[model samples]
Structures are given as C-alpha cells and as structure tokens.
Target: MNRPPELKRTLKNRHLQLIAIGGAIGTGLFMGSGRTISLAGPSVLFTYIIIGTFLFFVMRAMGELLLHNLQYKSFVDFTTDILNPTIGYYVGWSYWFCWVVIGMADIVAITGYTQFWWPEVPLWLPGIICIIILLTLNLLSVKLFGELEFWFALIKILAILALIGCGGYLLITSFVSTNGIQARISNLWSYGGWMPHGWSGFFAAFQIAIFAFVGIELVGTASAETDDPTTTLPAAINKIPVRVIVFYVLALTIIMTVTPWSMVAPDRSPFVNMFTLIGISAAATIINFVVLTSALSSANSGMYSTGRMLYGLSRNGVGPKVFARLSASGVPQNGLLYSCALLLIGVFLLYAEGDVMKVFTIVTTVSSICFIFVWAVILIAYLRYRRLFPEAHARSVYKMPFGIPMCYVCLIFFAFVLYLFSQDKDTLTGLVATPVWFILLTLFLPLYRQQLKKRISYTDSKHNH
Candidate 1:
C-alpha cells in the first residue's frame, strides 16, 4: 500500500527555538504596547504577566497532548480523536481562519510600515508584493520556511535587547531627555503610582494585551516538523516563563522605567518613541524597518500555519482533498496558494478604502476572539483525554502540572476577556462577528460529511475493480 505524502522533519532545534521565540513576540509588543500602557498605565505590566502565565499552562497541555502520539500532526489531530470529527472540523477550519484574518491584518500593516520610507507608494502594492514573496518562499520547502522564521525572529529579539540595554544605561546615568523627564526606576510609580488609571484601566488593558500573545502557540504547530518532539518540545515549553519575562515583562518594565507612562503616545509605537526620546534622530526610519520585519514575520507564520492546518483538515476529510496534496519538496503548495489567495482580500479592501488601521483593528479583535475559542478547545480536549484514557495519561512522560484545575482557570480567564471585549464598541463588533463564523461552519458540516462518504465509497469501488 502506498502511504500519503508527509511533511519532512528537517527543522532543527535552533529553528524550533527561534520559531517559538518569534511566535511569542509579534507586532503587538512593538506597535500596540503604547495603547495598552495608555489605557492601563503602568499596570499594563501585570496585564501581560497574568495573561502570559495562563497561556503558559495552555501550551503545557498542548505539549503533553502532542508528545503522547508522534503520529498526531498537530492539536487538531488529537482534538478529532478525543472529541468528535465534527468538532475537529470546526477547530481545524477556525484555526485556519484565525491565521488568515491575522495575515490580512499584517499585510495591511506592512503597507503602512513601508509608507514610512516611501510615502508615494500605494498601500495595496506593498501588501500584494509581500503576499507574493512570502507565498513563493513558503511553497519552496519546509526547511526554507523554518530558516526564514529563524532570522525574522532573531531581528525582533535583537531589537528588544537593544531597547532594554539602552533603557538600562539611561536609568543608571539618570539621563534627562529634552522633554525634561529624568530616566529612573521611579517613573513606574512616581507619576500615578502604578495603577494610574485604577483597576478598571488594568482590566481594560486585557483587550490589547491578549493580542500580544496571539502566536505563542506556534510551537505546538511546529511539533510535527520538529526533529524530536519529546525532548525538543519540553525544552521549548519549559522556557515560556523566561521568554515571557525577558521579552514581555522585563522589556516593558524597562520601557516604563526610562519614560513615564504619561509620556507614551497611544497612537504611535512606544519603541520608536523610546529611541527618539533617547536622541536617536533617525529612530523613526530604523524602527520602521524593524516593524516592517515584525509584520512580515507574523504574516509569514500565518501562511505557514494556515497551510499546515488546511493540510491537516484535508487529511481528516474535512476539507477538499486537493489541499492534502504535497509538492515534490513535501510542501503543502495547494494549501499555501489557497490561503494566500484569500489574503488578497486585504489588498482589495485597501484599494476600496485607504484606511489600513481601521481594518487592522477589526481583524485583530476578530483574531483574538478566535484564538480564545481555539485555546478553550485545547483545554476541553485535554479534559476529555484525561477522563477517557487514564492509563495513557499516567504513563505519559511529560505531564501537565495541575492540569485539570489550570484548565478551568484558563477558561474563566478567557471568558472574562470576552466580557471585556463587550465593553468597547470596536472589540464588541469583533465579538459579535465571531458567531457568524461558527454558524457558517455548523451549516457546512453535514454537507462535508456527505462528501466524505462519497469519496470513501468511490475509492473503495476503484480499488476493488
């Protein structure tokens, strides 16, 4: 019997490490932190810590599940097994849609980022060019995808490190900016005493803070392509705390310390502003290039994830079989092409209306809501796995600590965030738009099942003849 084409496990440990790092840091940290700080004040620090902690546990559960079976392609596989095929279909498609929406927003962002350097360039042109370039790279090979993400993630890491280093130097020397504010640790508390906007502001910050962690789960998706899941995955998951602290908590602390929360502009990137305040005259242009890479990195990850997810869906008979076809290089070319084609819709929107940021907000909120659903599904799947297969859970080498209890905590946290979304008109619009996606998936399931049955019957008949 001929086996189906499979993805190559050519990704090394370094690739996996950088991919995990890249996933944790997105444009949200670079571009969106200013808004979060403005809304929640210095308390935004706690917002990130709390969210990152919960998501760490979520990733642990996913790690345990993925390592339990090497044959499992990703979370969507076990989800289908532990739950039902119908749910598997919804989760797979929804996950794909989540990245698709994110990719669209990132492309729009890329256009805006490019405008900083080339003011006359049409918004849609850069978006179209980026999509094409990323598409070509992804279609080549899995190794190539891993290599690109490795470098993209490295740039982001270096940028954050430079910020922390520069901020530290300013603080130790008590450097005073042209604006007359002295760089010191007390800036975090001197102005408004941490909770500048109070608890209400802290709670509101979750809306934006959660978006910063959107791609943190990409490590789980890469499990299939990783060289050794058992060793590499645990190593990757164990470092979540340190990564969250250094990249998110410590980095933000440094920013707020050097410059008071009050001085940060909500409409602009704090990263660019921080450098400019410290006398980097060309900070705008330099940060623009960094942010451009950040956006491209995110869009690149989105394309990779969407392609793999579609392939997983097809393998399970939930999507068209054509999506399951692999190129000579073991790349999911059809899936990649389909996802990129859908992403062109963003370019179309840019042509229709020259408002990239408006589209970005709507799509970002929608992506965040979808991610919450996907996380909840993982927890639910974990609960089902523990209940149905106690022996397997007992024998598993990598166990999720306080697994059952933590699942509930994460769920409640997600529900609270969803409620927070209702408090704002823009986020509320996204929250409302979420159900339409699930409803569409629900309506299509029966038809999908019928198609699967027909495909099976035809395959059996051809084999027998």
Candidate 2:
C-alpha cells in the first residue's frame, strides 16, 4: 500500500539558519527604517535592541514547546493540542491570515520596486508575474522553497555586510559626502542627543519596529520539515541576538553615522539612500535590486507559511480537508495554490487603487496587528504547557528560561506595543479593523466544531463496518 503523504524532513541546518536570518531581516529593516530614524532619530537603535530582547524570549518559549513533542507540525498544532481546540482554531487561522496580509503587502511592494526600474509598466503586471513565479517554485517541493529562501537571504545578508563595511571605512577616514556631511560616530548624538523627539518619539518607533520582526517566528513553523529539530531549533533560536546585533543594530548605526539621522527620508529606503549619498549611483541601483529581492524573499516566506498553516488547520478539521492532502513531492500543493490565489488580491488592489503606498500602509498595519495576536497566542500556549504538562516541561532539554515569568513579561510588552499602535492614526486604523477578523472567526468556529464532530463520527462508523 502507498504511504500517506506527509511533510518531509529535507531541510538542512543551513536552510534553517538562513530562514531564521531572513525572518529577522526583511523589508521593514530596509524600507521602513527611514521612517523609524526620522521619527525616533538615533534613538531607534535602542528601540530595536529592546524589542529584539523581548522577542527572543518569545522565540525561546516557542522553541521549547516545539521540541517538547517532535510530532507537532508547528506552534499552531501544539497550541490546539495543549490549549482548547477553539483557541487553536483562532491562532492557526489568524496566523495564516497574518501572512496572507503580509504577502499581499509584499506583492504590492514588489510592484512598486519594479516600477523604479521600468517607470511605465503597469503595477499589477509585475505583481501577477511575481505571484506566478512564486507559485511555480513553491509547488515543486518544500526543499526547493528552502533553497530559494537560502539564496534570497544570502543576498540580503551580503548587502547588509557591504553597507556596514563601506560605512565603517567612511567613518574611519571621516569622508565627506557630496552634500558635505562628514561621517562620524558623533552623528548619533550630535543632532539631538539620542531620543531626539523625547520619550514619545521613541515609543512611536515601536509601531514600525515591531512590524520588522513580524515573521521572526517562522522557524517554529518550519520545525516539522527540519532535518534535526532537537539541535537545529535551539541553535537557530539562540543566535537571534547575534543576528539582531549585526543585521539591525550594527547596520542601522552605520547608516546613521554615514548620513546622519536627520537626512534620512521617511518615504525612501535608507539602504538605497546611503549608497546614493556617497556618490555611488550604481550602488543605489544594485541596492534597489537587493531590496526588490528582499521583498520577494518576504513574500516567498509568506507563501510557505500560509500553505503550512492551512495544512495544519485542515489536519485538525478546522479547514477544508482538501488542504490537508499532500502531493507526491511531499508538499501541501492544494494549500499552496489556495494561498497564491488569495494573494492575487494584491494585484487587484494595485489595479483598483493605483496608489501602492497608500494600500501598502493599510495592509502592513493590519498585518502587524494580526501578527501581534499570533505572538500573544504562542506565549499563552507556552503558559498552558507549563501548567498542564509539568512533567514534559520539566523533562524537556530545551526548556524556556524563566518560563512562566518570561511569558508574562512578553505579554506585557505586547500590550504596550498595541497601545503604541493606538497612538498613531495609520496603525490605529489597523488596530481597530483587526477585531472584525476575530469576530468572524468566532462566528465560524462553531460550524467548524460541528464539521469536526461529523468527520470523527464518519470515521468511527466506517472503522466499525
């Protein structure tokens, strides 16, 4: 008899490492940093550090929970098993929707980036093409998706390294730009002495900073496909601090030191701007290509995440059973197709609105709010693991440090971030609109429970016959 289809453990250690790195560094760090620096001045560096520290704990909790049972496909699976099935239903679907929104925004972003090179092309065309390309790649196999992300992430890693290396050289020589601003470390404090806009601006920076880290928990989702979860997951989670330092802290410091925080444009990418300011017009074009790939990488990860999330939901009877079926290549082909089809809404939005920036803002804010819910669910699930599975929690080798306490701390931090969202009109719109999703999920949850019960009965009756 043929074996039932399942996700394969084909992802290598290097794939997990790159995926972790790619998740931490995204378009938010590339494009949104300009707004962050402009709003918080040099103080944004501290904001990254603070937020990264708390999120690291969140990752630790997830790592421990994932390693506790190698059978769990993703955090959503454990969330359902440990918590009430209803809560799991909410988190799994919400996490899937989070990526769906993020993927749409990324598609819109890819269109905008392509227009930089081809000014006359219609925006929706590039988005549609990108979706098709991503769909083809994802439908092949999970390993192929990992391989593509590995290279996409490698490009971003090299780009950041290049920026830091060049910026360091400029700072060392005190090189002056064509605009006549001298590169120096003092640029960090000279403008307005760190916290330039006071505590309020520093707090405001959290809204954008949190969005940058939206996909950081992707490793949790990739657990089932990883070759060696016990060693690989903890190793990847532990290195988050180093990644944050080199990718966000060190990279941003170099950019600010080279160009001064005041000169960064809120609407443009700081990576591209830094290259242009230093008289390397060619480098700016190259960086644009890199940012374009960065957007693609994010969208690619979004695709992988949505498909896997839907598969997990389907296995638990919350989603259509079709999504649970795997292809001969050991991939969730149906789930992948459904995700790509939903993502076409991005193309529609582009064709309808013709204002990529406006649409991107609304979608990104909504995505961020949804991500906050998902992260909160992970922490809550971790708490339940500690109380309900004390033996397993105690025996686990990769136990979360300061487990319950840290979960509470992270939850508190999430609350503060949500309050920060309410402080801004753009993000507040997303915050207000996010509840409709939950209300809708609540309404449909009972129907899902009924379906699940019917399926269970049918299976039992067939087994008896």
Candidate 3:
C-alpha cells in the first residue's frame, strides 16, 4: 500500500537556526522600535530584555515537550494529547489567526517601507506584489522557503552589525550630526533618565514589545519538518536569548545613543533615520532596503507557518479537509493559497485606513493578544505533561528549568501583558475584539467534533470490511 502524503523532514540545522533567528527579529524591531523608544525612551532596552527572558522559559517548556515525543508534529498536537481536544482546537485555529494578522501587518509594513523610496507609489501596488511573490515562493517547496528565510535573515544580521559598528565609531569620535547634535553615550540619560516618561510609559511599552516577539515560538512549528529535531530544535531554541539581546537590546541601544531617544521619529524607521541624521544618504538607502526585506521575510514566514498550521488542523479534523492535501513537492498548496487569499485583506485595510502606522498599530495589537493566548496554552500543556508523565519528564535530557513554577510564572506574565492592553486606546480596541475569535471557536467546535466522530466511524467500518 502507498503511504499517505506528509510533510518531509527537509529542513536542516542551518535552516532551523536561521529560521529561529528570523522569527525573533521582525519588522517590529526595524519599524516599530521608533514608537517604542518614543514611548519608554532608553528604558525600552530593559523592556526587550525582560520580554526576552520570560519568552526563553516559554520556549524551553515547549522544546522539552516537543523533544519528549518525536511523533508530535507541533504544540497543537501535544496540547490535545496532554489536555483536552476542545482546547487544542481553539489553540490550533487561534495560532493560524495570529499568523494571518501578522501577515497582514507585514503587507502594510511593506507598503510603508516602499514609500521611503517611492513616496508617490500607490500603497496597494506594493502590497499586492509582496503577497504574490511570497505566495509563489512558498508554493514551490518547504526547502526553498527555508533557503529564502536563510538569506533574508542573513541580510538583517549584517545590517544590524554594520549599524552597531558605525554607531560605535560615531560615539568614540564624538561625531556631530548635520542637525548639530553631537553623538555621545550620555544621550541615553542626559535628555531624561532611563525611565524618561516614568512608570506609565514603561508599562505601555509591553504591548508593542510583546508584538515584537510574536513569532519566537515558530521553532516549535518547524520542528515537525526539521531533520533530527532532537538536536536542531534544542540548538535553535538555546540561541534565542542571545539573538534577542544582540538583535534587539544591543541594536536599539546603539540607535538611541547615536540619536537621542526624544529625537527619534515615531512614524519612521530609526534604522534608516539613524543613517539619515548622520548625512549618510547612501547608507540610509541601503538600510531601507534591509528593513524592506525584513518585512518581506516576516510575511514569507507567515505564509509558511499559516499553511502548515492549517494543514495540521485539517489533518486532525478541526479544519477543512481540503487543507490536509499536500502537493507533489510536499507543500500544503491548498493551505498556502487560502492564507495568501486572506492576506489581500491587507491591501483593503491600507486603502481603507489610509495611514500605515494607524492600521499597523491596530492589527499588531490584535495579533499580540492572540499570540498571548497561544503561548499560555503551551505552558498549560507543559504543566499537564509534568503531572501526567513524571517518568518522561525525569528521563528527558532537555528538561525545562524550574518547570512547574516557571509555567505559572509565564502564565502570570502573559496575564499582566493582557491587562496592560486595556490601558491604551489602540490596544484596548484589540483586547475587546479578541474575544470574538474565541466565541466563534466555541460555536463551531461542536460541528467539528461531529465531523471528527464521523471520520473515525467510517475508518472503523472500512477496516472491518
């Protein structure tokens, strides 16, 4: 008998490593950093560090669980096995929603980045082009998708390293900007203390900071298709903290030190603006290209993830069965097409809202809320695993440090971030809107269970015959 179609383990260690890095560093760092710096001043560095530390533990919990059972494809599967299937349905679909929203955010961000060079181009044009290109690339094969992210991530790493090196030179030389402000390390605190805007601003930064880390758990999703996941997954996950600090904290520190936090443009990319302030027009252009590709990298990742997520859900009977079918190349062609179709809503959003930042802020807020729910479920699943299989937990080489207590700690941290959402106008809209997704899930779950039962009964009948 022929084996049924399945995702091939084509992703190598290098692909997994670069993908983990790519997932952690997003357009949020390149574009949204300006807004975060404006809100918390230099204290934004601490915001990145705190968020990164908590998420590292979350990844640890997920890594240990995924490694414990090589048969598990993703967190959704373990959640169903460790907990109830109902909650698994909720998480599976919610994660798909999270990536869809992020994909839309990337489309909007791409248009914004293009406007840097072509201010007169229609916003919808670039967004459409981005969706088509990403869709075509994704439909080819998983390995090609991995290759694309590998190169895209490499570009981002190079750009940030160059920025840091240039910024350090400016600080040592006490270089003067064309605007007449001198670059100095004191820029961090001289304008205002670390918490320039006080506690309220520091607290407000979490909503956006959390959005910046939205895709960090993607390694969990990619684990199923990874070659020798036991080694690749742990190696990829172990490097998250270092990637977060260097890509986010260190990079932002250099930007704020070179250009005072107060002067940073909330509406523009600080990466490009930092170069512009120093009168390096050519460098600014190059940086713009990097950030542009950064947004494309994120959107491409979204396409890859959402396709796989839908395929997972469908294979389990929680989503449409069509999504379970893979192409000859071992790609989820139907799921990819479905996700790319929805991404067009982004062009509509751009046309309707007419302001890139405004649309980005609203969508990112909703995406962050959804992601928080998904992460909380992962931690809860880990808790369930520990209680159910103490032997497995003890025998596992990749144990989660402070397992039970840390799960509770991560859950509490997620709740605190959710509470922070209500304090702001834009984010409050998202917090209120997020419940609608759960309500819909609750409504459709019964039908899904019924379908699941019918599938099982039919399979039993065929076997008996």
All models: lDDT?
0.88, 0.88, 0.87
Q: What stretches of model 2 exceed 4 Å from their correct place?
A: 354-360, 451-465
In model 2, the Cα lDDT at residue 323 comes to 94
lDDT of 2: 0.88
Q: Write the per-residue lDDT of candidate 2 for residues 26-136, one digit (tens) a residue.
A: 788988899999999999999999999998999999999899889898988877777656777888998888899888888888988898899999877999899999889
Per-residue lDDT tens digits for candidate 3, residues 1-465, read 977778989999999999999889877888789999999999999999999999999999999999999988899888866776667788999989889988887787799779989999987899999898889988888898999999999999998887888888888889888678898888899998999899999988888888788899998888889879999999999999899889998899999888999999998888887676656778767977998899889899899999998998888789999999999888999999999999998888887745765756666677788888888999999998898789899999999999999999889988998889999898998788778778888888887988656655664464345
Candidate 3 has an lDDT of 0.87
Estimate the overall C-alpha local distance difference test score of candidate 1: 0.88
Worst 10 residues of 2 by lDDT: 456-465
Could you give candidate 1's per-residue lDDT for residues 300-382 as a string of tens digits?
A: 99999999999999988899889999998889999999999999987876776546657567766777898898899999999
TM-score of each: 0.95, 0.95, 0.93
Off by over 4 Å in 3: 119-123, 277-279, 354-363, 451-465
